[model samples]
Target: MKSLNSDAFRMSIAWSRIFPHGRKEKGVSQAGVQFYHDLIDELLRNGIIPFVTVFHWDTPQALEDEYGGFLSERIVKDFREYAEFVFEEYGGKVKNWVTLNEPWVFAHAGYDVGKKAPGRCSSYVDKECPDGRSGYEAYLVSHNLLNAHAEAYEALKKCEKCIGSKVGIAHSPAWFEPHDFKDAADGASVDRALDFMMGWHLETTMKGDYPAIMKEIVGPRLPQFTQKQKEKLKNSADFVGINYYSSVFSNHVEKPDPSKPMFKQDSLITWEGKNVDDISIGSQPVTAALPVYARGFRKLLKHIKDKYNNPEIMIMENGYGEHFGNKDSVAVGTADHNRKYYLQRHLLAMHEAICIDKVNVTGYFVWSLLDNFEWQNGYKHRFGLYYIDFNDNLKRHEKESGKYYKEFLSQGVRPSAIKRDEL
Candidate 1:
C-alpha cells in the first residue's frame, strides 16, 4: 500500500476465520478479529483509508455443511449475526463497508455453472454437480443473499459504533451492447441481460422487487420476496459498487425448452465480443481476453445514473488480467506494459464519466494489490499491481503498472509520462 501510493485500500474478511464453525455458539476467534484491527491500524498509520468487505464469497465450510450454505434461508440469520459482529468490532474505524461482494457471481458460478466452491448444479448442466437445480437454486440463493444483506444493513444502522458508516453491496456487472444496434430484438436483449445480471439485485434494492421482465420470464422458478422482506430490501444500500472489467455484445435468443431450465439460458440472450459482421468492439490485449472496451465503462456509468436514480457509485474492482506463461521471468513479468495500458484507458474513461458525464462516482479501487490465488483460474491468472514471486517465499515485486498508478494517483494523469505506443 505504501509502495503503491494508494489513498485507500479494500480487503475482505474470511467468515471461517472469525467463526470457525460458522456460528457464534461454535466460538468466536478473538485472534481473527484482532488481526483485522491490527491491519486496519497499520493502514491508517500509513494514511490509507480502509474499505472492508464483510463477506467475499468464502462462506464458512461449517455453514455449507450445516444447511448447504446459501441454498437455505437459515444461512441468512447466520450471515447477519456474523456481519453484526464485524460492524460492532470495526465499524468505528472503518467508515466504508461492503456487506457482500458480488453475490450474483457467487450464486451463478457456484450453483448454475458448478465451477466454484461447494459447486452444485443440475446433472444436465454439469454432471459433477448433481445436487443443484440450476435456475431454481441460483435464484433461491440470491434471494437469501439479498435478505442477509438487508439484515446486515439494518444491523449496521443500529450499531452505535457504526454511527456514520456507510454499507453497500459490491455488484460485479459488465456492460452489454446490442450485437446489431439496428435490430430491435438485440437492443431489447441488452435490457434483458442487464435485468438478469444487474437489475436482479439493484432493482430489488431500489424498488423493493425484482425486474418486471424477470418475473414475467422466470415465473415460478424465480423466488419472491415477502412484503416485510421487500420493505427491508428497498433502500437497503447506501450506494452501489460496480466491479467492471469489460463489455460484450448481446443478441436475442429464442426461449429455451421449458423442461430444461438453466440460469444462463433464462435471460434469452447470448453474449459475444464481435458483431455478426466480425468487427471487434475494441482492442484485444491478452489471449482469450474479453476486448478491453473502456467506452463501455462510461456507458455503464451513465446507464446506472439514468436508470438507478443516480445513486452514489464506486468503481469497486477494475483491473486487467494477464496469463503468466511458464517461461516468463520476474523481470519480464514485472514490466507489465499491458496492465499499464489497460489501467490508463479505463481510468481515463472513468474520469470522463465523473467530470464530463457527471456520474456521481465517489472512488475507484483496483481489482487487486497482489497477485494472489484466483478462484477457479487459480494462480494461472494474474491481476495484480505488485507481482508475487510464488516460487521464492512469495516475495512481492512492483510491476510497471504499479509505478504508473502511483504517479497517476499522486500527480493525476501525466500524458507526457506515457509513450503513445503504450496506449
Candidate 2:
C-alpha cells in the first residue's frame, strides 16, 4: 500500500474468529483480538488509515444453529453483544467503522435466492435449499439485520474509547435505468427498483422506515419497526458507504404472478443488461455478471446527494473482476488493461461527481489490494490489483492496474489532456 501511495485500507472482522460461539460469554479468542491489534498498528505505522468493518456476513455456526442466524430476532441481541465487544476492544484505535456490509445482499441472496451461505429458500425457488419462505425470509432477515445495525450503532456511541470514531453500513446498490426510456411504466419501475434495492436499507437508516413503495407491494411480509426502534434507527449512520460496480436496465413487469412470489419479483421489475432497442448499457467485460457502466456511478452519487439530504459518502468497494480458469498465467494476468481501464473510468466518474456535482464524497477504497478467495467463486474470479500466483508459493505480482493506480495516486489526478470518454 505504501508503494502504491494508498492511504486507507478497508477490511472486515470475522465474527467466528473472535468468538467461536458468536457470544462473548462463551469464549473470546485472545489470539484473534491480538491479530487485529497488530494489523491496525501496522497500518498506522505505514501511514495508512484503517477502515474496519465489524461484520461482513460471517455469522458463527453456533448462532445459526441456535436461532437460524439473522432469520430470527434473537440474533439481534447476540449481534449487539458481539458488536459491543468489538467496539470496546478496538474502538480507541480504529475510527472509521462499518457496522454491517451489504445487509440487503446477505438477506436476499442467502434467504430468497439461496445461493450464498446458510442457503435457505422455498423449494420452488431452489429445491436444494434446506427450508425457507422465498419472499418472507428475506424481509425478516433484513428486519433483524437493520435492528442489529441500530443496536450496534447505539453501542458504539456509548463506548468511551470510540469518541471521535464514525460508523455506517456498506450498501451495494446498482444504479438502475428504465429499459425503455419512452415507456412511462418502465420509468416508474426504475424508481421501484431503486427503492427495493438501495432504499430498503438506506431509507431505513436515514428516516427510520422502509420505502413506502415497498410497504405497498410487500405488505405484511415486510416487518414493522416499533417507535423506539424507529428512533434508534433514524440517522444511525455517520456516513453512507457505497459498494458500486455496475448498472442494469429495469424493465417494468405489468403483472407479476402473485402465485410465485420471491424477493426479486416483489418490485414488479426485471433487470436487463441491454435496453428494449438492443443497446447495451455499457461495455460487458469478460465477467458476464458485472457490466462496465461508470456513468452509473456518477448518477447514483448524484441521486443520493439529492434524495437523502446529501450525506457524507464513501465508495467502500468498487473493482473489476476477471474470470481465468486453468489457462491463467502471470503474463496474461499481469497485463490487465481492462481492469486498469475500468478503474480509470470509475475514478473519472467519481471525480465529476465530487467536483462538479458537489456530492459530499469523502473516501474511495478499491475492493482489494491482493487476490483472495471470493466466496462461492473461490479463486476463479480475480478482482485484485496484485495477481496471486497460487501454484508458486503464493507469489504476488503487481498487475498493470496496480501500476496505473500507483501512478494516478502519485500524480493526484490523470493528465489534463485526457478526456472522460477517451479512457
Q: Which candidate is the best by TM-score?
A: 2
Q: How does candidate 2 fare on TM-score?
A: 0.97
TM-score of 1: 0.95
Q: How accurate locally, in lDDT, is each candidate?
A: 0.86, 0.89
Span of ten consecutive residues with least summed lDDT in model 1: 414-423
With candidate 1 superimposed using the best TM-score fit, by how many Å does residue 154's alpha carbon deviate from the native?
0.2
Candidate 2: tens digits of C-alpha lDDT, residues 336-367: 88888888888888878888999998888887
Model 1 ranges off by over 4 Å? 1-6, 287-289, 414-423
- Look at candidate 2 and tell me the lDDT of residue 422: 42
User: Lowest summed lDDT over 10 consecutive residues: which window, candidate 2?
Assistant: 414-423
lDDT of 2: 0.89
